[model samples]
Target: MAQPTAATTTSDGYAEGRTDTETVSRTLATSESGLEVTVFDSIRSISAARWNEVVERSTCGSVFHRYEWLEAIEAGLGKTPRHLVVEKDGNLIGLLPNFVVDIEKTPFRRLSSSYPGFGGPLVTTDVAESLSLLAEAVPELCTGRTVVHQIRGLDTKYMRYNNYLQSEGYEPYRRECRFVLDLTQGYGEIYDGMSKTRRRGIDRGTDGDYEIVEEELTRPNLERFHRVYEQVMDRVDGDGYPLSFFERLLDMRERLLLLTIRIDGEYAGGFLELLDEQRSSIHGFFAAVPEDYFGDHASELLYDYVIRWGIDNGYDTYDFGSTNANFENGVFRFKEGFGGRILPILVWERGCSPLWKMLKAGRSLYWPHRYE
Candidate 1:
């Protein structure tokens, strides 16, 4: 993707000479709380120290907010996502990581950062102003003739795009709630915090009949994990499939960990997690169980072990990623059972002339359900 034309400060504020081709550009703007917005071709443009400092100041931010994870996503996933930084004169205030997602080979397109997961801008209390700047800037930067600005896994309260959608007749979007296990008090305190029944289940799995094993996906395990992943996907009636390339993605990135529940030597269920320095985030990646084991709570076994392992290893947070159901669904309920707190995700999107019309024409394709 081409970079935006040089930004020139002018009486009108800042005049970014329009680009001849389509692209997303980072610009410097003096905005709310005396902050300036800086755009990047990729998340790697910012140093890890600067990126993480902003995360530490934000409420829902975690170690997964580090630049290395963003770099891993970009390296493993073939998408060129851009990262935008909002600075206060010189100090960092906020971040908006976005990408230009093409529809395979079609003329269709959209802008996203971290897809299939709830990762948007991490900011202090300046959400409204930070989002407003993005709302106005997205349309101008898009290069696609018709692009759907897909703001993924958004927490509605802090977002600005919902207003635009309301006027545009897009209706309210879906809600997803994540399960987070808090580790402030120590693992023992956290373990005792669980309900007696859940505690028993974890203890029961320890009888050796159900072995909760933490294994990095070796070459053979990767192949086995893929087989189980495919079965789970098929059972869920899913399409727009996760490419086999993702197995390679996990291998290439080497940041992925596969936590599995083995029932007397059989692969009953599993969960995938992405680890950085201080946090292990559970990507709602994939899990599979035999029909007979559904009643046995193999899924719960997987969750419990992953959470326990994460806490024991001195990690600060065990993120349950996001779910399409906010107040409902077994996914959310099970995670909540572990005493997880809630955090809202937000997305801010704006469309350009050509892309807006195209999105309307191909609305179905532009807004298909995303299975990440």
Candidate 2:
């Protein structure tokens, strides 16, 4: 049964049409802060001024949620996928841009963001209202369809609602952790706060006439990043997602930024970072450096350059991306030297098929490390 809305059935005691074909009117629900909720199908459907206002107010609102970023992802994909927007009193409040992906081409579908990771709902004082609206809207949008809605990299607060989704036959699949760096105090202070020894190493590496520049990822740079990326991937036997995937991303120049790190004319290292300048973040993507030269702390130099570049280019945060166990990886420890903090990410998913749901749940419980 659908949740009760403002409208009621006709006097004849019968609805006009079948639920599948029926046009259901949206009912405004009250937010914890006493705001009303509305949903939009596209960015053009919402007011830009109001949208920016909500982003400014929310902690999770960042450049990644920007229209330009979504457009670029769409352009890279060669088409736009379905988008969902939440508004209050004709003002933008939350946004979700997602596409359906096949798990293994068995007619099962999973919702995905333009990028691999996204925490869609705005970070508001009233997370319950925002989450409740999302939960209610999605099933309505899906209607008769049964599909897995994989909410990627969400803040831990939403985990409380996992049971609510599970009651609707959705399975909670996987959850992971992501690392982020705070860049609000400006780059200089950020650098000053780093561990003394690590800072000394980075300074020593760069003192011998070192320089960094944000270079266009032309054909040459792409090939280089790919080659180095292949080497890094080979170590883990990581399967490459596809070159065309990145090429398509690079094509959307307005929504993307590719920066290469060169040390004294040698290609020391490079990273393809997504920039949301308005939100002041440099999202970490592909990263590569020569393995042999790694001992020289070339990667650290590259990081220093990238963080500075992000700040200079008007970005305030440097997202360090995902990390495994805290002890094994020195990179995580190094990032902490720069005042990086860890953000918990949960992967909540609902399965379309009962068998599929069981299989996914078992795989998640038994073989968590392999999939991740």
Candidate 3:
């Protein structure tokens, strides 16, 4: 049964997706483990304190798994939040944040822990047992709600998830790569590591013709950013993040930074950075500059500026985000120029309908970058 979800706030100032105080609890899996699994239809029913405690404690915990991000996802993307939590002896043990994504005009429906972000089940302790219960509770509790119930952003080093995934007959589907720049090294070394062309481009930004503007989230600033952003999306033949998405993102202003590059006091281009303290990383997200501004190497300068800022702020890594495995992709080549370690984009999936997976697989050959 589906529970009604209304936008509300928790006592701690986190966004809430439900008004009800009660949870749809179920005692699932082996009773021998003494762990109780409870499935939540709302983020409000679960205490933010307890939820964040597990997130902070788990090695796999990321900002995406944190309570606030889920709040933003619900508001920004308008996806209904779902969570599967586990407790043993009345103590919190595990959490998996999920949302229902139904593609408009299509039969595709999924229960994604996070649809477009990185998140997986997190446990405070007793990792093996907690993960077992969390994984097992999904199929029984989530059956028929969606065609697939999958988790994203599981690390390759954590074989426990892989072990359970195989045990439960879940399939590994998406294999992509993310670029991570090592920030432990000195600034000079980091700069030197970049391709010669990129280094020269960054230096060009210092030609006294460009300025980096850090502005407040006012209407004008946002409109200008979106203007450039829309053109960039059109240029790449990609869909731009809706204006409402960014509007809903205002809830995350404390952890978000919007920087635009100015060439002779004109808005040339900029990018938004998600300051992720949980991972000790700065992620390069939502960036754009006009083609006219390309000559000034504004894009390269944006990367250089953000990377320097991350280094000075003590962030351990700078992520260029993910791209396709294909070398021919221009985005991939652009990120490779900055000298970052390439790592696989791990996404775990379990589809209830083989027909859907089959059709998706066939479609994927034509659109390798898409997910069903």
User: Could you say which candidate leads in TM-score?
Assistant: 3
Clashes of each: 12, 1, 1
**What is the model-wide C-alpha lDDT for candidate 3?**
0.75
Candidate 1, residues 138-188, lDDT tens digits: the string is 555456343656555433333444565445433333445565667657668
- The candidates, ranked best first by lDDT, are 3, 1, 2
Query: How does candidate 2 score on lDDT?
Result: 0.58
Over 262-321, each residue of candidate 2 has an lDDT whose tens digit, in order, gives 566777766777766555567786677667666667777877877777667666678877
Q: Can you tell me which runs of candidate 1 are displaced by over 4 Å?
A: 1-68, 71-76, 80-95, 101-109, 122-136, 143-174, 185-204, 217-219, 239-255, 276-292, 326-328, 347-372
TM-score of 2: 0.64
The models' CA-based lDDT, in order, is 0.60, 0.58, 0.75
Which 10-residue span in candidate 2 carries the lowest summed lDDT? Answer: 12-21
* Lowest-sum lDDT 10-residue window in model 3: 10-19
Cα RMSD (Å) between model 3 and the true structure?
Answer: 5.1
Higher-ranked by lDDT: 1 or 3: 3
Residue 26: error of model 3 in Å?
5.9
Instruction: Point out the higher-scoring one by lDDT: 2 or 3.
Output: 3
